[model samples]
Target: MSPAATRTDRLPYSHSSRETKDADDHAACLSNWQQRYDQLSAGSFSGVFEEFCFGNVQLFREGLNQSVHQSGIAWPGSRTFAVPVAIEGTGWFGGEVYDAHSMLTLGGSDELDFRTPRRLEILACTADARALCDYAQQVDHRNIEAELAARSIAPASPEQVTALGKLLATMMASLRATPALLHHAQMRKAMEQALFATLLDTLASATTASASPASCRTRQLVVAQARAYMEAHIDEPITVADLCIELGVSRRTLQYSFQDVLNLNPVKFLRAIRLNAVRRALKSADANGRETVADIAARWGFWHLSHFAAEYKAMFDELPSETLKRRI
Candidate 1:
């Protein structure tokens, strides 16, 4: 029984016997780790893959004070997966501390660093994944989902843990909720199956009508690429036609993907992005009063002052001038 981790091509169905032994230094902290993992160890299943929607949950490792992410993707289609899974046991890193609410996203092939001096538990995700992929062609959700998955290694969210704790408490209180229990492998089976079924359905139906997920109208991989391009060239003028050429798809195809995946046409997407940049600038601009709404708006590509103001107000519920006016 050691704190050491065993790697595998897939989850080992019999890992419960792997026993977690601790160094004398970490042994005192075992109860903390045990308590945290036990709180969220739903169930396990036999499979090469398993998934779960984190209702609300969180965890803090044996002996850490703050969670610090190691290295991970924060954007969608960045190869960071958006699958949901369980949180269990002590992690491989020293004192795997985590927050009960850091908006975590989980995927394979990534490592996370967490630090919380006390025990922690967390879960985020809801029962309503809501028709997984029914709107995959919509670019917005896919983008956000991709980004969420990439950022999953960051931390758990309080909202998430609350949901998870409530779910488990209601349905699993009698089964086991102790850090000292030998193992709840049998109990974990149902949870694991649910996760597997969810993953299979979601990943399979990720795109509205792509022959497969990889080829969806707005393949998450491709939209992620487009977002990156837009971010890099925020100051430059980008057109839908340009994006179509860059993505190697026709204009209609691009529009269709964005429409389905994000519920937005390209122009709207670009405007929203530009407005965001303007808001950022306006927030930091001094009313020592050097910046003007028109100045910032035009710079961010919003040339028509009246039009930009209307759009900005609609999106952010505030006017650019209002933000600047507050400074006065």
Candidate 2:
């Protein structure tokens, strides 16, 4: 059989399930996730709901609530990887806590055994190994599979970890807000390349000691503290001075720390985080147009409607109203 010619005009397949309320609902939501594997199961019962699949990868932002779960993923000898962008609550994966820094293997025969009493929010990126290698070859003629296989859960640099999280969040938001992008072949392929490149770069540089371990750990702690503060007070107004006081660091120290980790100052990072939060609130709001964009922005600390709209568009490639209206 010959390969079919690529169809530029074909619509990209998009699937999203409503919120799951029971075991049957959860199974329906996770049907696609299990289809890629040969065997899968869950220990305890809870809810699972999500929108999955984009381009050559499956992008999942899952809302999970359960006591324990286990699955055997067999991708039929294909090389593939899964990145857990952000993990909330606590669980165990391979005898270690499955936190924000962990990556899951989706191909081959791998097992996922985890237990947690609380709910979890997880974003995962799963892609084909061959496609990733082809993308890596364009950048550097190295053995991409060798680099990927070097570590099941590659320890990424702090900045790389943060970047990957942002990439997943951005992709999820974009797919939901602008589903038309899925139909754009060139755009989807470009995004797939972008994802693979980030994975390759992060995985390949796992062992390079460009920075001292102590310094790296310290910087990660600082960034984590700052993020925690921002997330805790997301609805309250925050300033650089406020962060400095709350984090027990000077203004210059805080500025330099954020620059090193996020490549953006503290203020910009807060804005970006708030932008994402606002976008989420808009998407999850009532579809009957009962909620206003201004209300959502204000909830996320954006009081200036005009300024918020511009920054929202710049960050998400769409107006705030557009995101809300799309839900309807």
Candidate 3:
């Protein structure tokens, strides 16, 4: 254990016990965070953040047999985030102890050192000590990099940190519209999976450095089996039923899943996707703006003038005629 805050610092870390039960107030929590911030400046963290906790989550603060000296600037006492399978919305904020990495499990136990307000002893909580069995599990990196990291955050570019902080702060702001999904055992598991998926997408986008265009064959793969059959005999009376034969599902089932997952369907979806390729070719042609809408449409399998206009309008908002005018 470390010593509590001395009177000199402005960070108003309070000394409340776990049994107090009233520490969960959002107002009080925010106030404490402000005071802590007053005392501590950014750029003071160095550690493998082992675990974390918030007000009442410290189930065994006494058991750890701890002593921490409070910074006149830093709030007194360490707050460790536990092995939180899930913490819904209450536990983080803009200026508060937003412990993102605390949720990750570490194989070795941590012995954290601290300097006053700016530097902190890792917050101590019931879950600070990771069991050997638990360490094997790997997890996602929350999209947030600490705003104070050397790469993206600095006093010179303070707004960058501020902007990132606002984003992280705003996350889960709407989640409370639902029930206590954070504390729920099973819901937390589902959320963990959800968060993991979200992390994957975020990491991919961050590393990829572009909104990579959706690929044709990859998109076609959704309708590939059905599409191959459709293309084999464009003149044959191959309807949605024929598609069902090649794809191995009833028409309705196919439509529902394709529309639900990919936001497109078996027939019209294929037509739009195929036509999109043609449109791209026409727009980027070496002899730019020469191709007529009807020429492009016919090249991509659209024949009926009225139906082509309707589908084009539905998909691209403008009429095929308007697209031609622009191209001309």
Candidate 4:
């Protein structure tokens, strides 16, 4: 079945607000991007997205109530910047731990890798690439072409980050209270310029940091390679020993790599990934109903039915059968 439609209201430019109970549904709420969200923490998943756009610029606030691993390619030909306004625990963006002081930048079809904590709220802005660069050159009197290409997770001052978050939040609140404000051409133009100027100023104030230690970088690479291998052979029965041998690392090294990079052991992380995969398959099952819960579970290498069901329900707060029954 097709995904549930997002609730959107027509405005002078465009404004949308969506709340979703399903992770993938939340992933689909963002326009002009390919994204997939895997629920990591237990219990039910909830997400909120509020977006406003004028001309070539877009600003939005997104919140998730559960820990999730989000990976996707963001809007093509656009430069996107994200600031974490709140976080329940540790979060990662593009392999680096991020906090409220961090600003994540993505340019021109860059891949997105974010592992967010529960109750995470982010304020983000996306603008047409050429327009943003031109604006920076004309107003900021600076060339940001190289910086955008690098797309680093630069550190901005906490005050600047907080101010930017507040600006976006206040704008969203105002728009929600007075949707007709979007009809005011001068108001829209002023808001748009304010957003671009604030974001560019935040970027300008960011400072570069020293590189990560070689050992840490190596572990990150190992984890990335291992994850790719697991996804490629998800249907096969693979073990830690297999990963150790394949990656030419000791068992301790593999263990440390997973822990350091994802705060998860290899085994548990792999299982969670497979479980999410099974859930997605069940949700997207055909109307003909050719697959059973057990059939789908086995396809993802879960041969023990009872054990799988218990773990699935524990993670999602719903039985596999219930999920299949909801399939459209």
Candidate 5:
């Protein structure tokens, strides 16, 4: 698909508001991030993305209606800080569960893995890595480069998180209400400074915890190995027994590992991953080509057409044929 054109009327800065019913389209709404989202829950997908960019700072808000697994990287030379303003259920970032009081940080070029629940709303700030480090050093006399590189999630006081969230909301609201403010050089600089100060203050109050136990790390590794194996053999038939044999673990241990790390059994996780793979293929298929839905499903290990269609509709709220027909 061609990239969405940027709005030129906003002038020196960029502002965009987008709504999408397809998970992949929603994933593409954010600028500069290489993102992919797979819907994990059973429902029609709905998402809203709003972004404002000026100078080296970017702010965005994302609201998603379905549970989704997001994987990608932020802009190449920036660091991102994100917090959930509202969430219906729990979310996991880099294999660790986080709540409203937790902040997610990712360095430029770092891989991102997040599992978010339905009705999730998040506000995120991204700034040039060098600029962020310089601001922290100048204002707080603290060097945060190492901290940003090492941490994926940080625990912050409720007050700190709430204040940061409010500040982000205000900045976005102000820009959206009076976009001409973005054209004013002094106003843009002031907004950028305010964002940096608030974000740094929030980080300054964060508390770190001890590392995970060796046993826990082992389980995480098992989960990682299983995922890699599944991804490599996505088009082949796979079973939990097969995974156990390949990974050299007992069935119980494999089950416990998946449940502990992802809060899901092996069967469900495998099915979800394969289903998403099929969806991607269907969406990208040539509209005038000779491929059928059954062929794609079979390629993803779904041998039964009726069952595959039912499961596809149940999870994505659309038949496989419908998805293929609506390919863009």
Candidate 6:
């Protein structure tokens, strides 16, 4: 944390939490997340998050010991950029497992299933997708989504990710300590634009290696094998490295194959399949039976009911609760 804000700082919105040790505390800290979960019952919960909403964007730094999965009919009305500030356990976001060297970029309407086994810390900022797209064109006159898919979660250079993380840390500190500076509308807008520009630059610098024809064929095979593996192990936790080891290919190769052929991140594809499987189970079972949404979701490895229900509804246009409530 930075020095306390002086009277001169003037940011419009500012909120934060010390740390979360219980379910109620965690839930309260993440009210803006628009998510509901039973972190208390799950156990081993610890988390914190801070937010600064200014101009046309929202910035936050959040950390948790539990996995997070969210789904909804529509995505948030802003583009999102997430970078790992620090990570201890394995987690998946932006369709890619959080690595020491990667960044996740999502369009306004992108649905995400973020999961982790241990501690996961992230710095994220959200701005209107249209606004960001227009801003990109104004700067470079290029289609930002074309080059980097609307929801691209590719491997980024470690150096760049680290740099962005540092910048976010500084920004967070400033927001916390310099409230007076943010009160000025002009100053706040300038700060917002500068942060957005930095985020864009960091994303534009991410490098995903191009694959050759032979490599592409290899990736296709890898993708098929990987899909098979995911289906076989749908009920268990799976990781990107696990797929790489199973297919005897480098992580980079597998990543490229999925992006080139499926246009989906492997992690996300796995999640989608799992969600579909859960839906099928729900629809097939006797609605009159005692099976609850949480029970069924847990069977499919979805622990957060609210996140699961939201996601379930987004995909099928109905809630998991609705699915479980209707009789055959």
What is residue 180's positional error in candidate 6, in angstroms?
A: 1.9
Q: Tens digit of lDDT per residue, candidate 5, span 1-328? A: 1011233453668888998999999999888889999999998998999998878888999999999999998877788888899988689898788877788888887899999987899999888888877666554445677766568885467898899998898778767766655555545555666677677667763331222233778889989999899888876556554576677764455667889999998868877877898899999999889987766765554534565689899999999999999998
Q: Of the pair 1 and 3, which is ahead by TM-score?
A: 1
Number of residue pairs clashing in candidate 4, backbone atoms closer than 3 angstroms, sequence gap of 3 or more or interchain: 0
Question: How many clashing residue pairs are found in candidate 5?
Answer: 0
lDDT of 5 at 202: 77
- Candidate 1 vs candidate 3: the lDDT winner is 1
Q: Which candidate number maximizes lDDT?
A: 5
Model 4, 1-328: lDDT tens digits are 0011222444456778999999999999877678999999999988899887766777788999999999988666678888888887678887688776888888756788889987799988877777767665554444566665665585468887888888887777766765555564545555665676677667663331222233888899999999889888866545554576577764456667889999999878867877888889999999696777766765565534566799999999999999999988
Stretch of 10 with least lDDT, candidate 6:
1-10
Candidate 3 segments whose C-alpha is farther than 4 A from its true place: 1-179, 182-186, 197-215, 223-328
- Over 4 Å off, model 5: 1-10, 205-328
Q: List per-candidate RMSD values in Å.
A: 19.6, 13.6, 20.3, 22.4, 22.5, 20.5
What tens digits encode model 2's per-residue C-alpha lDDT throughout 1-328? Answer: 0001122435564556566545445544542333211112344545555654555566666665554354445333334444454345556654566556666444444454444435566666666556665555544334666665534555565677667777777766756665654554544554665576567656655233242333666766888898899888876545554565576654445656788888998768877877888888888888765767866664554534566799999999999989998874
> Cα lDDT of all candidates, in order?
0.40, 0.59, 0.34, 0.73, 0.77, 0.62
Error of 3 at 203 (Å): 4.6
Q: Encode model 6's per-residue lDDT on 197-296: one tens digit a residue.
A: 5665576533423423336677788888888998787765455545655676654566678988899987577668868877777778775678766666
Off by over 4 Å in 2: 1-10, 31-48, 77-89, 114-117, 206-328
Which has the better lDDT: candidate 4, or candidate 5?
5
lDDT of 2 at 303: 37
lDDT, candidate 3, 163-208, per-residue tens: 3223222222312232222233323232223222222232232323
Deviation in angstroms for 256 in model 1? 0.9
lDDT of 1 by residue, 28-142 (tens): 2221122121112222211121112111111111222222223321112112222122333333222333333333444323343333222223322222222222222232224
Residue 185 lDDT (model 2): 52
How does each model score on TM-score?
Answer: 0.32, 0.53, 0.24, 0.58, 0.60, 0.53
Model 5: pairs clashing at backbone N, Cα or C within 3 Å: none
